[model samples]
Target: MTSKYEIRLNSKIDIRRIYTNETLPLRKKVLKPFLTEEECINPGDDLTSTYHFGLFQENKLISISTFIQEGHPDFLSTFPYRLRGMATDTEFQGQGLGGILLQHGVEYLRQKECDFLWFNARIKAFPFYEKLGFSYYGPLFDIKDIGPHKVMYKILIPK
Candidate 1:
């Protein structure tokens, strides 16, 4: 199944709150092909505080991410949140939609006065997260068969 690409580079992509299940398609196609769709459902996804954010272009969900209220063992914060299951549709990669999605999702944490956000980012996407002001710490690590990953986090400010 493929989504039709009807939006141009300058078009505004809609970033919206989505349900946990809505993230499975992109998660399966981009991040977890080795696992079944049912397996793509990440742990804690159904938790009351867990949130899913999706990027839509031409009404097609092109990028998705999951956020949970969890803290990094080495990082201390009042309300530490973790981001996971981030995937951008291959066709929509390099279009800056991922950053836009992050900016939108960060607002949620900002509203809740979260102290920081952290995630294990794939090494290849380290620069992308860096561009969004996230700092990488610790050494590169592997997530099972998912290649190299490193811990990244950003401090949040509440207004």
Candidate 2:
């Protein structure tokens, strides 16, 4: 016997553009736990073309991801977006909130005429990015003690 099922959340979530300061603690907690909050701040985070998206439930910021107008050195495009500092609160992990954040983030970038979004995805998080239509390129490399990572990109094909 075989069966398939799904559960849709009718719950309301606010996907909003948030300031970088609003994202630091969650970024430190989820992404850069071993380092100081100062270490979690990425290079292009303060750029005018960078946009940080946060998922809020009942006014509590739960998950966040940043999109910047930085192209992958390998993937050339007029407006390639780089996805950075994506993190969901540990308490809310495995509930599909990360997927929601990516979906909304992609749409927002597409409207700005971005050709694609790319990032250095962690090995453990590879499956999650794959599910959202991102593919990998380049050899496996490392960041000091942060483990291995590969460059992954998702193209927003025109409809």
lDDT of 2 by residue, 1-159 (tens): 111211223456667778888889999998888988888889989999999888877678899989888887777687889999999999998989989988888887787788888999999999998998899999999988688999999887533
Off by over 4 Å in 2: 1-11
Count of clashes, each model: 0, 0
Best by TM-score: 1
What candidate 1 gets wrong by more than 4 Å, as runs, is 1-12
> Per-residue lDDT for 27-46 in model 1, tens only?
99999899988899978999
Sliding window of 10 residues with minimal summed lDDT for model 1: 1-10
What global local distance difference test value does model 1 have? 0.85
TM-score to native of every candidate shown: 0.90, 0.90
Clash pairs, model 1 backbone? none
Candidate 2 lDDT trough over 10 residues, lowest sum = 1-10
How good is model 1 by TM-score? 0.90
